[model samples]
Target chain A: GQQVMQIPQYQHVQEGEDFTTYCNSSTTLSNIQWYKQRPGGHPVFLIQLVKSGEVKKQKRLTFQFGEAKKNSSLHITATQTTDVGTYFCVSSHQAGTALIFGKGTTLSVSS
Target chain B: GAGVSQSPSNKVTEKGKDVELRCDPISGHTALYWYRQSLGQGLEFLIYFQGNSAPDKSGLPSDRFSAERTGGSVSTLTIQRTQQEDSAVYLCASSPPANEQYFGPGTRLTVT
Candidate 1:
């Protein structure tokens, strides 16, 4: 079975601090998707990385895909209270199949 | 342009009873998926439907779990003889072709 392992099951940081979450796997991945789920809310699509060693940015957030394509990381700078939520890393082997999700890293920011 | 929608935001059923959860995907989406999430746990794959193709039920935990997609639009998940362990939040997501998925609010099921 394929699995994505995310580090730091939970993290608490100050509002102005930076945070990072990593997702790794023993097997090569075709693509990786990141999602955010607020408390009592559904998962929302954040970004997707497909190419190896690719790096994409969304405002204060940066997503990077490892050269081997088996790992990915999400880094957020100057975290805000709105950043509090669980971040999940997702991957799928083929189209039209179920997405494999990581355990997710819950982020809490205190102002 | 409404997103995915699910019914019965919350449900409480007695042990050994059966329950049905509903999901309505966005118009024209060709793929739909179901997942379960327990408290403080990650999303667990359940089932997937793609257009008119045979659904992938490999993720189903038990025969007690079943799902059907009607007319490539709506879907329903049926759980029979529910047990206390059946308690969790059931989420439905729909995607167009190979794009990102749009998730519904999910249905919380509690079996007593």
Candidate 2:
């Protein structure tokens, strides 16, 4: 069985500060996906990375996949109160299989 | 519908009772998955179904838990003789082959 581990189980930052969360796995992964779950809401797909050493950016957020395919990270620049939520890293061996989810990093931003 | 839909957004049952949760995936999606999340916890994989293939039930926690996908469109998760430990939020997600998943609002089950 593969396990996805995430760091900083909880993060608190002031508005305009930066935040980052890391994800690692014991085994190699075919793809890594990031999701965000707001309080009292379902998890929503954010982005996915497939290639090694891949980096993708969305507005103020950046996602990176490590060269070994066993690690990934999400960094948010100048965080805002709206960025408060749980960010989860998920992975699956294949496209349509069950995904292994990390415990998630819950981010709290104070304005 | 436009997205995955789950029925009975919330459920409350007594210990030793049985409960069935329903998940209606997005139309035309070939894969459906079930996950459980306890309070302040991560998502726990429960089961997976891809098209008409046999479901992957390796994630089921115990014999009392089971699930079925009917006609490859809808799914039902049944928990027989539920215990207090069964209290958690059950989430359903659907995806087209090799695509990102769309999640439903989930069913919050509380066993008293």
Candidate 3:
């Protein structure tokens, strides 16, 4: 069975601090996707990394896929109150199949 | 276009009662999925539908849980004789092949 594990199950930081969550998979993944779920909101797609050693950035957020394609990381800089939510990493052998999700890292920022 | 829509935003039911949750996916999407998220827990894959292929039900917890996608658009998940432990949020998502999934606001089911 395939499994994705995310570290730092919970993190709380000052409003101006940076945050990072790591994800590791037991099996090689075709691609890794990142999502954010605001409090009481549905998960929303943030970004996806398909190539090994790929890196993509969205404003203050940066996503990276390991060269082996089995791991990934999401980093956020200068967190804001609006960034308070659960960050999840999901992967599948290929798309159009059920995605295996990592135990998300819940981020809490306090101003 | 609608992202995704789910009915009965919240549900409260007594134990042993049967319940059904519905999900309407974005039009033109051929893949649909169901997932469960318990309080303070991660998302659990339940099932997946791709185009006309048979759905993958290996993630279903038990025979008590079943789901079907009608016309490749709307989906329904049914739980027979639900138990208190069945309380959780049911989420539905749809995506194009090899693309990111778009989720619907989940239905919260509370089994008393």
Rank the models by DockQ, top first: 2, 3, 1
Cα error of candidate 2 at position A68, Å? 1.2
Q: List-wise, what DockQ does each model earn?
A: 0.74, 0.78, 0.77
Cα error, candidate 1, residue A10 (Å):
0.9
lDDT of 1 by residue, B1-112 (tens): 7999999999999999999999999999999999999998889989989888899898899999999999999999999999999999999999886678899999999999
List where candidate 3 sits over 4 angstroms from the true fold. none
Q: Provide TM-scores for the models.
A: 0.96, 0.97, 0.97
TM-score of chain A of each: 0.96, 0.95, 0.95
Expressed as tens digits, the lDDT of each residue in B1-112 for candidate 3 is 6689998899999999999999999999888889999998889989989999999998899999999998888999999999999999999999998689999999999999
Poorest lDDT segment (10 consecutive residues) of candidate 1 chain A: A92-101
After TM-score superposition, the amount by which residue A104's alpha carbon in candidate 1 deviates from its true location, in angstroms, is 0.6
Worst 10 residues of 1 chain B by lDDT: B93-102
lDDT of 2 by residue, A1-111 (tens): 366999999999999999999999877888999999999898999999999999999999999999999999999999999999999999986656777789999999999
- Candidate 2, residue B97: lDDT: 73
Residues A23-86 of candidate 3: C-alpha lDDT, one tens digit per residue: 9986789899999998888889999899999999999999999999989999999999999999
Model 3 chain A poorest 10 in a row by lDDT: A93-102
Interface RMSD, every prediction, one decimal place: 1.5, 1.5, 1.5
Itemize residue pairs with steric clashes in candidate 3: none
Q: Report the C-alpha lDDT of model 2 over B25-73, residue by residue, as the tens digit.
A: 9999999999999998988889989998889898899999999999999
